[model samples]
Target chain A: MAALSIKDLTAIAKKTKESMQISAQGPHTKITVHMGTCGIAAGAQKVMDSFKEVLEIVDKKDVILTYSGCAGLCSNEPMVTIERYGEKPIKYINITPKIAREIMKQHVQKGNPLKEYIIAKGYENIV
Target chain B: MGDSTMSKETKKKEKTQTIPDLNSVPFFGRQILIALRNRGRINPESIDEYIAHDGYQALAKGLTKLKPTDIVEQIKQSSLRGRGGGGFDTGRKWASAAKATGEPKYVICNADEGDPGAYMDRSIIEADPHSVIEGMALCGRAIGSTVGYVYIRAEYPLARKILGHALEQARAYGLLGENILDSDFSFDIFIKQGAGAFVCGESSALRASIEGNVGEPTPKYDHATEKGLWKKPTVLNNVESFANVPPIILKGAQWFSAMGTEHSKGTKVFSLVGKIVNTGLIEVLMGTTLRDIIFEIGGGIPDGKAFKAVQTGGPSGGCIPESLLDMSVDFEELSKAGSMMGSGGMIVMDEDTCMVNVAKYFIEFCNSESCGKCISCRDGSEAMLEILTRISEGKGKEEDITLLEELSNAIKEASLCGLGTSLPNPVLSTLRYFKEEYQEHIVHKRCPAGVCKALITFTVLEKNCTKCGVCFKNCPYEAITWKKKEIAVINQNQCKKCGICYEVCKFKAIERK
Candidate 1:
C-alpha cells in the first residue's frame, strides 16, 4: 500500500474495503482472525486458504476474514472468530488448515458450533 | 515542465495512500504518547522517517508556548508516574528539578533497563530513537534543564547508535540546540554508555556511571531531584516514563485519565514473554483485566496446559498465582497481589513451571546482578541463593524454609538500596503463595514438575516401550539399554537428564519423575 498525501485515510480504507464486499450467506457475520506477525507466521495464511477452499466446495463464500495483531501469545496462531447470524462471535484458537476445514464444514455450514473449539464467546451479538 | 509534471504525478500517487501515523488500536486507543508512540513501528536508523511522523512536534511545542512550570503543570494534571518501577510522580520530579535553586539543572533518561524480561524501554530506543530524543527535549523544556544524559547499556549497541543519530538530527533541525523552535529555549542531550551493570538501573548508580565512576547506587534519601548528577538538580526518568510525557502535553490529562483506572491512567506496555502463547510486546490500557491479557490476548497456555502462575515485575517482582487472574492491572492492584507492575515486564507461566525452581532461577539472577555495594544485598542474596539452590536440588531442610523467610525479611529491611530491599520479592511471594511446593521439594524430596535434576529420575515404562532402539540412539549419554525385545531399561546411574531419550521416542515410553 502506498502512503496518501491527502487527509481522511480511514475513509479511503473503508471505501476500498466496502467496495470489495460480497453478498452475505444470510445476514451480518463478522469473521475476525488473529493476524499479528507471529499469527501470520504460524500458518494463518494456509488457514485462511482452507476457509476459502471450504467455502468454494460448499458454494458459500459469504464469510468475511478480518485480522488483529498478536495478543502476546505466540504459541496460538491463526485465531479465528466466527460470528453466526443472530449469535455471538466465538473465537477458535490454534487454527490450522485442517482445523479451519472442520470449522467451516461443521461449525459454519452445519450451523451447530463446536463448543470445545470455542475459546472465547464474545458478548457482541450478530444482528 | 516534464520534471514538474512527474513530481505532480508522484504526489498524486502518494495522496491515495497517506494515512495518519497515530495508532488507533483499542488498547493504545487513548495513549497520548510522549515516548512509546514510535516504538516497534519505525526504523530507528532512518532519520528522515522520524521527522515525517511529527517526532519533534512536542519538542517544538515545548520550546514555544510552555515554560518550565507550564510543562510541569501539564504533567501534574496528567498524573504520569515513573515507569522505572519506582511509581514516583513524573510531574513532581520535574517540578522539583525546575524549582531547584542551582547553577545547572540536569535531565537524565535511565536507559539502563536491566530487568531480565523488560525490553519495553530498550525496544523503543532501538525502534524509534527520535521518540526518546523528542521526549528528552520535552523533559528539558519542562524541568528547565539545558543538558540531558541518556545512560544506556553497552549490550544495546543498536539503541546507543540510533539514539546518537537522533541527537544529531535534532541539532541540525535546531530542535536540540540554541533557540529551539525560534524560541528562548536551548537544550541538548549526551549519550552515556553503561557497562552492563544491573545496579546501573538504579537512579543514583546510573548517575554515578554518567560521571565516569564505577556503576554503583547511592541512597535516594536526599531526593536526587535536588542534588543529582554532579550535585546539580537532576530529573532522572526511565525510557518508558519519559516516552509518556509528550503525549500528556499534546493531549489533555482528561484524555489519558479516561483510558486507565481511577489512579493508574494511560496505556502500559509489557514485554509479554515466556511460557505463554504470545512472546512479544503488548501495550494495553490500564485496568484491562489480567484474565484478558493471559487468556484472550495471550491465547491461553500452550499444549492445553493450565496456567499455574505469572511472574510480573521481573527478578524483583513476585509470582502472581492463577487465583488472581481476574485482577485488574494497575500499579497498586499488582502491588496488593504481592507483585509490582514493575517496569512492565510480564512473563506468563504455565502448570509446567516449577514454583520452587522458578523462585530459585530468579534468586540466582538477582545474586549475579547484585553489586555487593552493601552487606544486606550481597550477603543476603548469597545466603538466599544457597537455600533456594538446596531446595531445587532436593537437599533442602524443612527448617531452611523458615530460615529463608527470616533472612529475606532482614535483607528487605536492612538493604542499602531498592536492589537489596526488593531482592527477596520473588522468594517471599513464592513462599507465601506456594509454600506446599517448597515443602514437597524439601520434605518429600520431589519436584512435581519434574524440572529439578536432583529431584527427578528417568524411567522406561515397559508397557509403552516398543523396543525400537530409538531411545538408545538418541540418548546423549547412552543411558538407555535393551536386553530383550520385551522392554528397554534406562541406566539411572548413567542418566544425564538431557531429555533427548524422552523426545526421540516415537512411543510415549520414556518417563521422568
Candidate 2:
C-alpha cells in the first residue's frame, strides 16, 4: 500500500545492475552445457535441447556443446558454463527455459557471459 | 624426480595421448577381479559388451550351488579390506550384518564417493554396474536380505541413469527382485541420490540420506551393520569393496590375496593425475612402489620439471616427499608416514607447484565443503585457509606457521566426522615435508615455485634477450614495449608475471623472480 519512491527506485536500479552484470560477462562463444548426471536429473537435458534447437534454427551448429563433470554444488544442477573470446568461463546455475532464452538472446546473440545466474565465477582464479 | 612420461606419439600430434606398454608395469594384463577387469576395456553403458565378458557368471553361480556363508568364507579368506579409506575388514562387515538382530535385513552399496580428486568408486559405478549388483546379490543371499540401495551422488547423473537400466535388466534376468537367480532368496535394489555432503560418504550418514533425512552425519556408534537403514540390519560396503566380492567368490580367496603385500592383498586402482606428462587411470598391484607408478605407468612429470610431492588419498591423505618416492604403497605404511590410503587418489606435484599454494588449495576445499556441523571443522578450516592465503600472499609472519599447526591439531582432534578429523592432512603434510618452502614465502618473501602471484615478479634480463619478439606477442596485458635502441623491455608494474612470455621466448629474455 506504500507509494513508489527513491528507495524503491534505488533497489530496482541495483537489481538491474546486478542482472546486467550477469548478462555482460564476456565475449563467450563456447557454451559448455553441464550435461552431468545432476544436470540431466534436474532437467538440464531439456535446457540443452532448447539451446541446441535454438542454435540449429539459427544455423549455429558450430557452437560447441561440450560436457563436463559435476561442478560439486549438487543443489544447483543443470549448470551452464559460457565462455567468449578472451574471457573467463562463467557458470550459470539452476538454468531453466525462460532464463536460458534470455541468456540466448541477451548474451549468446550479443557477447555477454551472464553474471547474475552465476553460482561460481572466475574458476581459473579460484581453482 | 625424473620424467615418467612415456614416449609420445609425435606423429599424431592431434591426439596428444601416449599409449602405455604393459610389460613396463607389474601387473599389466592380468584380470583377477570381475569388477575392475572390465573397467578400462568396455563402453560402460553397453550391456551387450558387459554380457559378452562373463558379466553375470557369478550371479549364475550364486543361484546354483553356493550358500551365502560360503561366499562370506571366500571373502574372509581373500582378507579383503574396505577400499573406502578405512581398511575395515569386509568379510566381518558382511557377517555382522548377517547376525544383526532385525527382520528386514538390507544390503547397501556406498557409492557416495565425495573425496576430492578420487573417482575410483564413480568410475566403477559408471563402468560396471553388473559387477556391483552381482556382489550385492551375493551378499543379499548370504544375509537373507530382500532389498539393496545404491546411495550414489546426485552429481553422478550418468552413473544413476546407467545403474537404473542395469537394475531393471538384472531383475528381468531373475537376478534381482523376489527369488533372485530362480532361487528362494529374492532381492531388490533402488537408487538414493545424495546431495553432495562430504560427510555423507560415512556409513551412518549415508544410511540417513537413504531414509530421506538431511545428509548431516552424527557419531551414534550404532554400528551401521547392526542398526542401519530404517533401524534394521543393513550392510553398507563401498563401491570398490563390494565390487571385489564377485571376484573373491569366483577366483577363491588364496588367489585373490596372493598379489598384494603381506598385509594389503590384491590390486588397487589409483587415479594417477598431477604435473605428469601422462595422466590417466592405472590399476596396479598393491606391493608396487610409487616410483614404478609415476614412471612406468604414469610416464613421469611433464616439461622436465622436478618432482616435488605426491598427494595421495585426496584431502584426507598426506604429501610424501621426493625422498620417499620409492616407498611401498600399502595401507599401514602410508598411515605410518602420516598419511592413510583413503581411496587411492594420487596427485603428483612438480617443482613449479608452490607448497603454500597446495596447502591453500586443500584448505579452501575443506572450508567450502565443511558441512558446518562442528565448530572446529567450520572455524579451524577457515582460519587455516586465511593463514595460508596470507602466507602465500607474502603477508605472513613467522608465527602464522605455528598457528597453522595448532589449528590443524585442534580440528583433527575435536571434529565429529572423518571429513573434519582428517581435514588437516594437507596442512600437516606440507608443514612436515616442505617447511623450508613456507619459510621462503615468510622470510625471503619469494615463491620458490614462481606460482604465488603476490610473491613473484617478472623482470627482463637484457643479457638473455635476442630481439626475437616472441615475448612481445605472448604478453596478455601488452606490457612489453620495444626498447628504443635494443630488444623489448618489460613494464614491471604492468606485467602480470603469467610466465607465458618467459615460456615463449626461446632466449629467455623474461625472468620470474
Candidate 3:
C-alpha cells in the first residue's frame, strides 16, 4: 500500500459519492428512524424494533437502516423516514409499533407508503 | 493562481448545494447543522460513510495545499471561538502554541463535558467521532504538533467506544499516523480517560489529570498555549470547537462566519432539557433567540405548563426569566443578561420549578465539585449551599437572603478557575430575576412554585377525586388509601413527601398546598 495519498483519498471519496448516487437510483431502500431524546421519549425504540421485526419478516435484502437525531418538531415524534430508491422520501409521524409493522407490510413489501400516518411527503432532502 | 481560484470557486459552489425540501424536513426550518452536519445523516461507525459526506476532505485539503500558518490564518479569519464555555478564539490559541518554542508541541481536545444536564460533547463524539478526529488532526497541523490527546470523560462510555473505533479506523486507513495524506506532517491522537471529575473540564486541570495528577484547576497566570501539559506549549479546544474545524477548512472562513451573529460565528449545539416538551440536542445559529429554542425547537414546555425561565450554561450558569426569552443567545449577549453561555446546556424550567431550589441544586453541585483549592470557593460554596438548603427547607431567616448574596459574591471574586468563579451565577441570577420567589420563600415562608418540599403540603381533594386507585397503587409508602367508588385519602404520617401520588393522580385530585 503506497501510503494513501491525497489523490487516493479524493478518489475514494469520489467512489463513495458515486456509490451513494447509485444507491439513490435503485436497488435499495433507506429507513431513517429518528432516535433523538424526544423521539425515544415518544417510544421510538419500540417503533425501531417493530421496523426491524417487520423488515425481517418481509426479508428485503437491499434495505438500509439508520438512526437520526431529533428533527426539531418533536411534537410529532417517533418519526420515521422511508426513502425508496428513485423516489422521494416519506416521513411518518406519531408512529407506534403496530403502525410500523403496517408500514413495513404495506409500503416496503408492496411499494406503497401509508398515507394516514405521514406528516409530510417528499421529505428526502430535509436533513 | 487562476486555476487554484477556479477550483476554490467550484468548491465554494459545491458547498452551497442545498438539500432540497429543507422546509419540509420536520425541524430543519430552525436548525442549521454545521458542526452537526453529519450527525444523523451518516453511519458514524463507518469512515467510508463519513468520507462520503465530505468528512476528512478538509484534513486532506489542509495538509496538501495549505501551510500550518495558512490554516491558522483561515481559522482566525473565520472568527471561530471555543464552544467549551470560555468562547475564546480558536485561531489565537493555535497561533500562540505555534509561535511558542517547544520540541514537541501538543494539541488537546477537551471532551470532559461535565455540565449537569449537558451532553452536547458526548453526543457529537458518539454521533461523529471522525469529525472530531479530523478536527484534531487539522489543529495539530496548524499548531505544529505531531501528537494530540482527547481527554473525554469516562462516564460517556458509548462516545469513548465510538471515538476509539474511529481512531482505529483512521489509523488503519492511514488518515492518522505516519504522514497523513502522505504529507510531511505526521499526526497521531490518544485518548486520556477522565475519572469523571467536573473540574477536569478546565484546561490546566485536564492537563494535570492527563499527567497522572489530581484533577484540580491551577491558576492561569500564564496562558496554556505558552505553557501546558508537561510544560510543553499545548493547544486545548473543546469537542464542539474541534468538530467545527473540518467544516471551516472545507468551506472557507466566510461560509462558517456567515451563519452566526456578527461577533459569534457558526452554530451552537445545545442539549435542550428540563421541563421542555422536546428535550434533545439542537443546533441553531448563534443569534437565535431563547424563545425560539424553548418554544419552537423544544416544542415549548410539556403538558401546557407555563414557561417560567430557561437556564443556560450549566450549574455554573444563570437562569434567564421569561422576560429575557427574546434575548439572542450568544456568548456576549448571554453575559450581558447575567449568564455566560457555559457549554450549551439550555435547561428550560417551567412554572413548577422554584428558582430558589434551582439555585440551591446548582450550589450543591458546585459544592460537591469544588476542588477545595481556595477558601472562598471551598467555604463560600459550602456556606451558600447551607443557606440555600435552609431557605428551600423553609428555615430561611429574613437576613439569609443578603447573606447568601454576600457569600456568592465573595466566591465569585476569589476563585481559582471558571468553575469556582461561575459558582455564584445561579444564585445571583435567580435573586435578580426571581426575587419575589425568594421573598416568598424567606419572608412569607411559602414556596410559590410548590417545588420546595418542606414549604408545600400534598392534599387529596374529594371534589375532584373519581375514586382513582392509580395514586393508591403508585404511592411508594402506601400513603394513599382508597376504596372503590370513594375518594382517596393521603396519610400525612406515612407520606414520605415523595410526591409520587401527586404525579400519578389522574384526576387533578392531589393538590399541593
Candidate 4:
C-alpha cells in the first residue's frame, strides 16, 4: 500500500465531516426506528419495511428514515420516534406494521399523531 | 459479548438506516461519551464514518507535531488512570515502558473482559473498534513500540470480528502497517483470542496465555511494562483505557482532565443491569453520585421495588448498601466504601433480593473461576462457598459467620494474584453491610427475602386466593394444585421451594414461612 501523506489524511477527514454536515442541514422529517434486540425480537424488521413501503407509495421526498438502539425500555418494544422540522418529536411504543401504516398516513402525512399509542410527547421541550 | 448476535443485528440495522443526530435529543446530555462518541451514530465497518466524527485526528496530530515523550507528558498531565479496575496511573506506565531499555517493546490492549455483568469493553469494541485501534497506534508511537496485540476473549465474537476488520482497514489505509501516514512511526496490531478463562483477564495470566502457557498469573514481583510477553518490555492497558487515549490526544489533556474528579480523569462506562428500570450501557464522569446513576439514569428500580444495594466491581468487588447511595463513584471513593471498581459492572438489587444468597452467588463464581495455581484461593474460596451454601440452606451454626470472616481474610492475605486477593470482597461487604441478615438465617433459620429454598416454606393463603391460577400456571415445578373456583394449594412433597410461585403471585396468595 502507498503511504498516505498528512495532507491526504486531513483532506479525507475534512470530506467526511462535510458530508456529515450536509445530511444534518436539511429541513427533512426524521423517523427513527428503534432496532435494539427487544425491538428486533418484537417484529421491528417488518415495521421498518412497512415504513419504507409507505414512504415509497406516497413518494415522500424529504422524509429521512433513521434507526436507533434500545431506549432501555424492553417491555415497550418496537418503538418509533418521529421528528418533524418544527413539531415536538413523538414516541410511539409497541408498534406493529399495521400501526406503522397508520403512523405514516395520520402523523407523517396529516400531522395527526394517534394519542393512544403515544408513550411520550413534547420531547422537544425537554431538549 | 454474552449476546453479540443480537447486537450484530442492531449494528446491521444501523448500517442500512440513517442515524438520528443525537445533538437534537435530550438523551445525549445524560451521557458523557468520550469512548463511545461515535457508537450509535456511525457505521463501525466504515473507517470514513469514524473519521467524520473527528476520529484519528489525535494520531495525525501526535505523529506530526509531538515527540514520543511529549505525548507521554500530555497523558501525565491528563492524570488518566487504567480503567480495567486496577486504577494505576496510565501515563506512569507509559513512561516506564518508554524509559525501559528494550530493543522491541510491545503494546497489549486487554480486551479479555471476564467480569460476569461487565460488557463496557465489549460495547466499545463492537461499536467503535477504530477508536481502540487508533488509541493503540498512538500509544505505540508514544512508547516507541512497533507491534501491538489486542487479547480479546473468544466469547466476544462480534467484537473480535469488528476489531479484526478495523485492523485490516487501518493497514490498508496506511494507519497501522509500515510507515503509518507517511511518518517514521510504523506499527501493526494482531488479535489474540483468549479461550474464555476469567483468570486470563489478569495481566500475567494474559501474557502467559499469549505465550502459549497455561494462563495462570505468576507472582507480580516484576511489572509487565518492564518484562512481559516473550520477556520484552510491554505496555498493557485495558480496552476502555486505550479507547480514552485518542480523545485525550485530539482534545488537549486539560480538556480530558477537566471532566472527572481530582484523582480520576475522564468518563467511565458501566454496564448497568439487574432489577433497574433502564438496564443498558451508561457512561458518566468519574465522580458522579451513585444516587444519580441509580435514580436519574437507571430510572430507579422497576415495579416499585425499593433499592436494597448495588454490587459494583464484579465478583471481585463488594455490595454497597442503600445508605451509601449518595457516595461519589470514583476509584478512591468506591474502594474506601469497600468496593473497588472492577471493570464497571453495576448490579442493582431490590429489597426482595436475599443478601446472603447474593454473597453466595459471588462466592460460587469466584470458586469456579479461581485458577488452582494458588491453593489458598482455590481451597479457601471453596470453603467460603460451602459455608455460604450451608448458611443459605438453614444448616449453618452461629459460629459459621465468624468462621467465614476469618477464612475470607486469610484467603485475601495469602492469595497471590488479584483473583485471590480480592476474593473476599463479596462476602466481606455483605458481612459488613448486612450482617443482621446472616444472623437471622443462622439463629432463627429464617430467610427474610425468602430466597433460600431450605429455609423457606411456601404456603397458600386461602383468604387472599381468588382462584386466579396465576401461580399454578407459572410454577416451574408444577408444585401448585388448583381446580375451578378453588384456592390453590402448594403440595409440600412436590414443592422444591424455588420461590417462583411467590414471585408470580399477584394477589399475595402465596405466603412464605
The per-model lDDT (C-alpha) reads 0.74, 0.74, 0.83, 0.83
For every candidate, what is the interface RMSD in angstroms? Answer: 13.7, 22.8, 7.3, 8.0
Off by over 4 Å in 3: A21-25, A33-60, A66-80, A91-100, A115-127, B1-26, B466-474, B481-488
Q: Any idea what lDDT model 1 has? A: 0.74
Cα-based lDDT at residue B208, candidate 2: 75
The TM-score, computed over Cα atoms with residue i paired to residue i, of candidate 2 is: 0.75
The parts of candidate 1 lying over 4 Å away from their true place are A1-127, B1-35, B39-41, B483-486
Instruction: Estimate the overall C-alpha local distance difference test score of candidate 2.
Output: 0.74
Which lDDT tens digits does candidate 3 get at residues B12-113? 444323224445443555777877777656666778878887878899899878999999999999999999998999989888998999768898999999
Model 1 chain B worst lDDT run, 10 consecutive residues: B19-28
- Tens digit per residue, CA lDDT, model 3, A19-63: 554263344677878775557779989999988887676655667
TM-score of each: 0.77, 0.75, 0.90, 0.88
Better of 1 and 3 by DockQ: 3
Q: Model 4, B250: alpha-carbon shift in Å?
A: 1.2
DockQ values of all predictions? 0.06, 0.02, 0.29, 0.21
lDDT per residue for candidate 1 within B1-513, as digits (tens), equals 999989876764453223222132222222333345554223455545555555555665665667667878888878888888978888888888888878678989988888888777766776567777777888888777899998888887656776798788667666677777667778889988889989888888888889988878887777788899998899998888777776666666666667778888777878777777656666777888888887766667888988888889988899999889999999999999888988989888887789888888888888999998889889888999999998899899989999999999999989887888898999988998999999999999999988889988889888888888888877778787775565888898999997888778878888988
Query: Sorted by TM-score, highest first, which candidate order results?
Result: 3, 4, 1, 2
Quote the lDDT for B492 in model 4. Answer: 95
Docking class of predicted structure 4: incorrect
Candidate 4 deviation (Cα RMSD): 7.5
Clash totals for all candidate models? 18, 15, 0, 1
